[model samples]
Target: MTNIPEGKQMEAAIQNSFNEAKKLYEKHGIDVDDVLEQLSRIKISLHCWQGDDVRGFLNKGRELGGGIAVTGSYPGRASTPEQLRDDIDKAFELIPGRHKVNLHAIYADTDERVDLDELAPKHFENWVKWAKQKGYGLDFNPTCFSHEKASDGFTLSHPDAEVRQFWIDHCKASRKIGEYFGRELGQPCVTNIWIPDGYKDAPIDRLSPRVRLMEALDEIFSDPIDEAFNIDAVESKLFGIGSESYVVGSHEFYMGYALSRRKTVCFDSGHFHPTETISNKLSSWLLFGERLLLHVSRPVRWDSDHVVTMDDELLDIARELVRGKLLEKTHIGLDFFDGSINHVAAWVIGTRNTLKALLRAMLEPVDRLKEIELQGDYTSRLALVEEFKSYPFGAIWDYYCRNAGTPVREEWLAEVKRHEREVLCKRSQGEGSVV
Candidate 1:
C-alpha cells in the first residue's frame, strides 16, 4: 500500500515546507506563490494515443500505420472509448494540475465506420460532452495515416489527385470539428495536420509532392474559421520508418509555410534529428509565429516516442520557455507512447516529469541571473547557477503536489499498481480487447 500522508498531517507538512521555501525564494526576489499559481494554470495537453497505443476504434483494432509503431504487449489496453476515458481520468487523479486532452480524428466515437471525407463533428460529440463534464479543454488532429488510401506511404501529397483530395477533405472536416470544440468549451482549439507523405527510397520529383501538399493545404484552410474558435496548424517530420530518404513536410517547408500563412508552427521535440533540440528554437520561432504547438517527447536516437523524463534536455526545454516567458505563447502537449509498462503509469510519469521540469525552471533566480549578466559579471552568473542547484525546490514541489491532492513522489505508483490488479487484469479474459 502507498504511504500517502493523512489529511491533516499532510496539509500541515505542506504548509510548513511551503512557508520555508517561500522565504528562501523571496531572498532571491522570487515569488513562490505566484509561480505555483501560474504553474497550476498551465495545461499540458495529454495525448489520447498513449492510453490506446495509437490503435483507434476504426477497422476494429487494426495495427497502426503512418510511420508509427507501439511496441510491446502491455496488458489492459483501452479498446473502447469508455475504457480509454476511465484510464485517462485515473491517471489525471495522480497528476497535480488541470490539463487538456488532445484527440486524433480516428478516435471518433461512432457506431458506423466513418470514411475520411465524410467525418463530421457529431462523431466526436461524446468526447466534447465528456471533456465539458470534466471541465477540460480539447485539441484536435487530422488523421492522415493508417488507412487504405495512405497505404503507399502518402496521403495529402499523394500523386493521385483523388487520394490527395480525400485527405484534404478530412483535414477540412477536422478544422470544423475543432471549431465546434472551441465554441462549446469557450477556448480556442488547435487543429494540427501531420501527414506521413514520403518515400522510403530515393525518389525523383520531391518538389512536386511538396507543391501538391502546399496546394492541398491551401484548399483545407481556404474557408475562414474564426480564430477565436479554432486555429489551424501544420506539422513536419524529419523522417520515419518507411520514409527514410525524404519527408514532404520537412521543418524548413513547414517553417516557411507557417510564417507566410500566419499559422501556428508545431515544433515536435522528437521529430528532429537526434542531435537537434527544439528548446533552442523557441525564442526564434516566437518572434515570427503567432503561436507554437509543442509536442513534448523523448526521442531515443530517433523518433521512438519514449516516455518523457526530467532529463537535461527536458530541463533545458522548460528553462527556455520560462526564461523567454513563452508559456502564454505556447501550447504545451505530450506526444509519446510507451507500451512496455503500465499505460496509466506511463501517462502519470510523463506528465509529472513535465510538470516537475517546469517547476524547476520557475524556481530559478532568472532576474538575478539577468542582472548579473547585464552587469558583465559572467563569473558571478555562472557561480550563482551552480549555487541555485541546491535550493529546496523538491520541498516546494512536494507542497504543490500535496495541495493538488495527488500522491507525493513515489506514492502514486502504488495507486497505479492497485488499479492494474483490480481493473486491467480483468480485461485480459474472455474478450477481443487486449491486442
Candidate 2:
C-alpha cells in the first residue's frame, strides 16, 4: 500500500502550505488573515427551495406551474419541513461561516390550511423559532406562482380585478411575514416579488399588462412597513418557459420601477440572456441604487438553474463586488435547484464554490491594481491580474475551511456520502419513493 499521511500529518501539511501562501500574499501587500476575516463576515442566503425541489408544503401534489421545473428524480428529497430543515442543517455544517436562509410564502410551516391570500406571520412562526435557534437570519419571497390563480400564467397583472387583487393581498401578507422575521431576528428581511405574467406568443397590447402590474405594485407598497424590519425588492426575468415571447417584468421594467419607487432590484445570475453577465451591471446599479439583491446561480444554456461552479463569471462577480466595495450594500442569496444529486451536496458544492470565488477575489491586491491602472500602465495591470491567477489561492482557501472548522479541500464529499447513506437513503427506502 502507498504510504499515506493521516490526521496530524495531513494537518501539518496544510499548515505549511498556508504559511507559504500567506507570505506570497503579504509580498503583494495583501493581509491574508484580514481577508479571511472579511470573508467570514459575508453571509450568503441559502434558498430553501433547493432542498424540496420547489415543492412547497402548501398545495401538496400540485404541479410546479409558473415556468418552474426541477429536473431529476433525485433520491432523498425532503418531503416535509422537518426533513428540509435537517438537510439544510447538514449543508450548513459543511459550508464555512454563518449564513441566512431564504424562504417563500409557500414554505410556511403550519397545519392550518391557508391559501396564499390568507397567509400570515403566524404561519411562519415555527420557521422564525427554528431560525432563531440556529442563529440564522431569514429572507422572504412572495409565492406568486404555482397556484390556481396563476394557472393562466397571470398574477398581479391579471386582467380580472379579483385575480389581481388576490395576488396583491398575498404579497402584502408576505411583507408582514418578512417584517416579523426581521423583527424577531434583529435583521432586515428582504421580501422579493417576482411574478410570471406574460404571454406565450407576442401580443399587441403589451402595455396594458405592464400598466396593471405597476398599479398593483403601487397598491402593494401603499401600506409601507418599517424598512428597518422589511426591505422590499423586485426581480425581473429575461424569459421563462411559459413567458418565452413576452415577460412583463423585464430588466428595464423593474429597473425603472425600482429606481422610481426606491426599492431594491434583484439581479439573478441566470435571469438574463446567455451572453449577458450580471457582473458588468454591478457598478452601474450601485451608482444609482442604495442597495441590491443578488440571486447567484449558474445557467448552462438558458436559465437552467444549475448548481453554481467557480467559473470565470463567478470570479468576475466576486471581484467586482470586492473592487467596487459593494458588499455592504448587497444581499447575496442563492437561487438554483438541482435534483439530480443529493440536495445537501448540491447546497454544499454551490455555496463552497461561491465562498471560494469570494476568497480569491479578496486575496487580490485591489489597491495596487487600481494604482497601476491609474498610472496608465495597462501592460502591468493585465500582467499582474493574470499572474495572480496562478497564485496559491487554493492554499489560502484550504486554510479558511480548516480555520472555520469545516472540511478542507474535498474532505466534505465523504461526509456528504456518509449522510446520504445514513440519513438520505433512509428517506427513500422508508417512503418507497424518490423525488
Candidate 3:
C-alpha cells in the first residue's frame, strides 16, 4: 500500500496522460477544450452543483481557452414572489451575459400554507419585473411545484384534497411565473418537471394522477404562453434507504407518454441504472429529434447520487446536446444537489467532473479514427465508459515518484493522503477534523 501510487498523483498522472494521448488526434485541430465546448460549453451551475471541483477545472481549462455554462440550485426552491425577484437579480449579476446559464427552472415555496390568490400573481410579477428591468441576458431559472405544504410532490401525489388543490394552484402559479419569464427575457426560462413523489411500496394508483396532472399541463401548454418554457422531463432514479423505498426515475417516461412529440428529454447522468448507457440513450433521443436538456451528476453505485465523477458520461451528454443530433431543440439545464458531503465541494466537484467529461467527449478522431467514429455511436461510448478505456494515471504518477527519490507506489499513496488532507481542509472550512 505504501509503495503504491496515490490517488491524487494518479489523477494528475491520468490528466497528463490524457494530454499526451491528445496529440494522437491533434491533426483535426481538435483538443480537449474544443471538444468540451461542443458539450458543456463549460457552463457551470451556481447552486451546490458548481462547487470547487468544477471551479478548479474550469479555471484551469479556461486558462487554456475553454468556456462554461452556469446552471445552479436556486431554481428548485424559489416559489414565492419575493424569492423569485431576489434570485433573478442575483442570476443577472452573477450569471447573465455569460450565457453559461440557459436559465434554471426554480421552485419557490415557503413554510406557510399561503393561498395562491394572495401570492400567485405576485409570483408572476416578480419574474416579469426582474426580466423587464434587466433588459435581456439575465439567465435565471423557475421551479416545478410547491412541496413544503405538500411534503410529497404537490398536485401530483398528495392524498389530501386540499393538499392536492393547493398544489394544482401552485403549478399554475409556476406557469404564471413562467409567462413573466418568457415575456420579459425574449426566450424561455426553463421549467423542469421532476417530483419527489413515489415509493417502492406504494400502490399503482399513485401513478394514476399523472395522466390528469399532465392534462392540466396540456391545458396550460395549449394556450401557447408556456410553449417557450423549455419544459424538460427530468428523470431521477429511486433508492432503498433506511426508512422507505423512494420514488424516482419515472418522470421522463411519463412526460413522453403524456406529450409524446412535444416535450424534451432531459437526461440526468446518475438517474439511470448503473448499467444504463448514457451515450446509447442519448443517441436514441437524438434519433427522436426533440429538444434536449441534461441533469448531470455521477453515481457511487447505481442510484446513489454522489456528485463525484470524472466519468465519460459527462462527455457524451455534453457532445450530444451541442451537436443537437438528438433533442434537436435542446436547452440544457442542471438538476444538481448535494444531499451529503460538503455541499459546496459536492457542487464544485460535480461541475469539474462535467467539464472533464466534456473535454473527453470532445476528443474527436482524426481521419485515422474514421472507422472508430463510424462504429463509436452512443452505444459504443457507454461500452467505452464501462470498459474504463482510460490512460494509466497510476503509471504516470509512478514515474514522478521515482524522480522524487521515492518508491513509485509508496509515493503515490502518500500523495493520495496529502490530497485527502487538502480536501478535508476545504470541506471543513479550515475546521476539518477526523476521528
RMSD of each: 2.8, 2.0, 11.8
Among all windows of 10 consecutive residues in model 1, the one with the lowest summed lDDT is 426-435
User: Residue-wise lDDT of candidate 3 within 248-294, one digit each (tens)?
Assistant: 33636544643474665556666666777565566666565455566
Model 1 misses residue 144 by how many Å?
Answer: 0.9
Q: Which rank order by lDDT, best down to worst?
A: 2, 1, 3
Ranking by TM-score: 2, 1, 3
lDDT (Cα, tens digit) per residue for candidate 1, span 218-300: 99999889899998888999999999999999999999999998999999999999999999999999998889999999998
Clashes of each: 0, 0, 49
Candidate 2: regions farther than 4 A off: 1-5, 430-435
lDDT of each: 0.90, 0.93, 0.44
**Per-candidate TM vs. native?**
0.96, 0.97, 0.58
Q: State the lDDT at 158 in candidate 3.
A: 52
What TM-score does structure 3 among the candidates reach? 0.58
* Candidate number with greatest TM-score: 2
Clashes of 3: 49
